[model samples]
Target chain A: MSQVLVVTSGKGGVGKTTTTAALGAAIAVTGQTVVVVDFDVGLRNLDLVMGAERRVVYDLINVVQGIAKLPQALIRDKRIDTLSLLPASQTRDKDALTDDGVARVIKELRAKFDWVICDSPAGIERGATLAMRYADAAIIVTNPEVSSVRDSDRIVGLLDSKTKKAELGERIEKHILITRFDAARAARGEMLNIKDVLDILSLPLLGIIPESEEVLRASNLGTPVTLNDPTSAPARAYCDAACRLLGQDLPMVIPNDRKSIFEKLLGRRAA
Target chain B: MSVLGLFRLRGTAPVARERLHILLSHERSNRGRPDLLAILRDEILAVVAKHVSVDHDQVHVTMDRGQIVSRLEINVELQHPANGPIAAEREKAAMTIVHQASR
Candidate 1:
């Protein structure tokens, strides 16, 4: 059975697109056919992140507006044959994405793809709502901060009340993926701990992607961190999250910022 | 500061949880479930008043959210009119109306 999952966070700059690309790539690596749809109209970046920016000619708007067919707009990744990218139009306005058009495209995508991962734009506007309109499950990307957590809560409320399943009285599956988590800072009481976020959001923890420069490097290189450096901390965490999405019972391991024994000994001696 | 005070440094976590809980509760009340308790109380009172005399303030309606099913508690006091088991009949009638209204 195919499933549509939306990676959404009400606040911007919380790594929703990054999470979508990583998870989509990781899942595709497991031999599952996956397509990541960029739902951020007018500010299309999924194609760039997927390294398919130059390859995108006809986009989601073209398909929705009947200017191009679904197959014509779909960009299949050469690196991973099973993975595809449905890029959004960078020049089109957000109003171009109509409800009926989105429903048609999503229905078609679900017929061919095993996992349709929609990367939602920041905010609770028409674009974001349409992205999540047909989702069977939601991965809420949140940072370990007050404003991010608060906005995530609002999105959770909307998911419970606004989604198609919600309107039909069926519960929509929700998971929390905390992005840019700095364990060292949290240990030093500078940032909120994992437990603090969980307490506020009250959703099952999918995975914690640690704050790392590798994520930026991977994006700049036009490759998802999972495909670029699978051994990196963020990549491993995202892979683990993808496994969890497939119903695997994996223990969440929060990566620690490595400190040498010499530093530990020096601190102890000073104490 | 005392050593205990160091451990008890108030964080924004608890505050966030409290604020979210209050906000969500208000939203649910406004959009989801209506004031069913008040309506049930009025309906039960109207049903019981026909059988036996009762005060307007005699009916009490409360809701307790439990682990399994949320329980709705209703209480009604009946004034005896030279009592010939009229209180019991009125109670049964009120209970029937309440059960029907709930469904």
Candidate 2:
């Protein structure tokens, strides 16, 4: 069965859609058949972020509502052959998504793909809950702030109680992905540190995406940061996260100029 | 020396005290036990009323950060019916009553 991963955060503008596109692209680069689905409904940003907005003729609602078949709704990426996108409907109402219809679509996608990633909408509403209903694992995207962390705590509670795996007494693996991290601000005590966030949330750290202009640029260009600028800080961090998701033993690194210098020195020493 | 005087003299670490206060407040407003004080007050009133005439409105019960348990304070005006007139006893009871209720 395909691993269903939901990229979700309780608070908005915490980089869920961005992370979904970047991670989906990164995973697809490994030649795995991956389809990133947008469950954000009316506010469909994933298709635009993935640079496939024009290609979206039939969307998730179309497939779920039986207006379009799954193959007809799946938008193949021009850049990556292994990657495809199931875009959200811009015209459909959020209430149009029925649980049974969603379940059938997810079941169908799972059988056909290696990785089925769903980009969840923000907040602990029906849209978010449905996106996570059938998830085997979750990427709990959070920002280093009090409100975001509190909202994420509520999301964690829902994940424990509302998921199918949880209902069946099976544990759903959850990882904390802290995005928009500013190291300098954190050092100045402006934002919560990594240790403090981990202490509060008590979930294993996935990877941190630093606040970078590259992310905004990638979004504007309708491409994932990992694909737009593979060597950039945010892209590298996302790629590392994708690798970790694939069960690789990747060393966690703090993205900073000092760390980069240290890496270079260590490389020279080894050479 | 008074117990409170000793606490003041010791000058308990402010950071620890602040953390304790914050944690206590958080626990009080915690999702699991937001109405803990009210529950405790009701239970205490029920228990105390069985033994003596407790002025339920005048009863004071509170939970503070420094204390491990809830504290209950009650001020009662004892009425010796055999030694005094009913009117005098009632007047004394009314005068002895404190206005401040539970925290």
Candidate 3:
């Protein structure tokens, strides 16, 4: 069965779009059919990151409002045959994405792809909520910083209270992906280490994308880091994250709080 | 990197962690907390009242984040009526268990 996942961070520029493209490409390289849908309306850039910008004849808004067919709107990757993208409309506002429209598109995507990843716009607004509304799992993109971690905590709150799974009384699987992690800075106590971020977010550690210029170069070249330089640290991290998403067993940066005995012993607490 | 910083006590990360701990705990406690806490206390008191009489003011429901976990600690102070049989014994027994353990 296919899984719908959302890459979200309560704060912008923490790499939701980058993660969406890299993870999707990495999964597709493993021969799994993956489609990354950009939900950041009026700022659609997943196609750019995936190098499918010029091929976009239609967009998510077009498919949702019946302006175009789903096939007509989805842009297939030039490099990876199994990878595709459902680009958001740069001309439309956040209000263009309706709940029912998103649900229909997600259901259709689910039937066709092995993985459907949505790149949520920042903050807990209509755009962000709609992006995560239909997700079976969430990749909480975060950076090792105070503001970013705090925003992620707020997103966790919304994920627990506002999503479809929460409304149905089912828990949506959540994973924390800490990106741009600088080990040297952390050692110097300038940046928050992986442990500090995980302790506060208290979610399963997906993978840590270390600070690297390769990511920036890949985006500038209109390619995902995993495809541009597969052996690089950031690329390897993204690939590991994709594998973990596919149920591969791997060691993490540290002990994640989801498995912490402290939580197990404490049981459920007052919300 | 000062002398105090060498001891790992002055990093901004620690400060941020401390601030987040306080903020999240406060925010968590307020997640439907005011009425929810009252309802939980009343419901728990009602259950205990079925087996043993408990005063409405005797039940306390709290949500806290210790170093270990986010906890919903419930403390029901079971006190015997002053005139009841073995009331003195029950009073002595009550002090044995703090709010840390629950049956």
Candidate 4:
């Protein structure tokens, strides 16, 4: 059976979009058919990150409003045959996405794909709520910062109260993905450590994506980091997260940001 | 303490953790019982006032957070009957019996 998962973060700019694309691509690389639906209606950019922007002749709103069919709107990935994208309409606002319309699209996607990942917009408004309305599980993206962690706690409450599972009194499986984590900064007490975030949210840790320039480079080139630079730190972290999502019991690999041996030796000599 | 220790004492992590604790508790209790305690206070007041002259406005109910268990405190002040009337002794005797029988 297919699972509908929402990649969500209450605070903006906390990497909900990046995590969606990377996990979708990583899962697809494992030969699972995955379709990532962009739920950021007015600020649609999942297609750009997935390198399917030019191929988006029709979008989610078009399919929802009956102007286009699902097959016609789904942009199949060129590199990964099993990966696809349902791009959001940049021209339309969130009002264009009706609750019934999203449910229909999600049901259809669930029937066709092994994983249907919804890329939720920031905030707890209609756009974000609708994104998580049909999710069987949620991957909450958070930064190792005070505001992000606090907002994530709010989202956690919503996950318990405002979802269909919540309405039915069923549990929606939740996992926390800490992004933009700087280990050295955390050690210096500049950023919250992973344990601190975990203690506050009390959700299981998914994987930690270290702050890396490779993520910016990948997004700039219209590619997911996992596929763009598979060997990079962020990409490896995302890959591990995707595996964990697939029920693999791999130990989490926390990336270190300590100074290199050469740098430390040079600093000692200079001193 | 060193200056660094002072900064650590006032660090954002500790502050954030404490804030989230209070916020989450308030949120959880609000979600489960936003008006339940008030209704309960009113009901208890109605039952008590039937026998004893109690001030309706004096009924206060509060829930205090505790380590292993939450505490619910209810305070209600009883009013004395006017003019040393016979009804005062009867009401007091009834209240005493009610309290003792419950105990």
**How much TM-score does chain B earn in each model?**
0.49, 0.35, 0.40, 0.48
Per-residue C-alpha lDDT of model 3 across residues A25-104, encoded as one tens digit per residue: 99999899999999999998898998888888999999989899899998889899999999999999999889999999
Worst 10 residues of 1 chain A by lDDT: A262-271
lDDT of 1 at A53: 90
Best by DockQ: 3
User: What DockQ does every candidate get?
Assistant: 0.12, 0.04, 0.38, 0.21
Q: Runs in model 3 with CA error above 4 Å?
A: A253-271, B1-10, B32-103
Clashing pairs in 2: none
Q: How far does residue A146 in candidate 2 sit from its true spot (Å)?
A: 1.0
- The residue-by-residue lDDT of candidate 2 on A1-64, one tens digit each, is 5899999988999999999999999999999999999999999999999998888899999999
**How well does each candidate superpose onto the true structure, as a TM-score?**
0.73, 0.73, 0.75, 0.76
Give me the runs in candidate 2 sitting further than 4 Å from their true place.
Answer: A256-271, B1-103
Clashes of each: 0, 0, 0, 0
- Ranking according to DockQ, highest score first: 3, 4, 1, 2
Candidate 3 residue B76 C-alpha distance from true site, Å:
42
Question: How well is each residue in B3-26 modelled by candidate 2, as lDDT tens digits?
Answer: 877555433233333443455445
- Model 3 chain A poorest 10 in a row by lDDT: A253-262
Q: What's model 4's TM-score?
A: 0.76
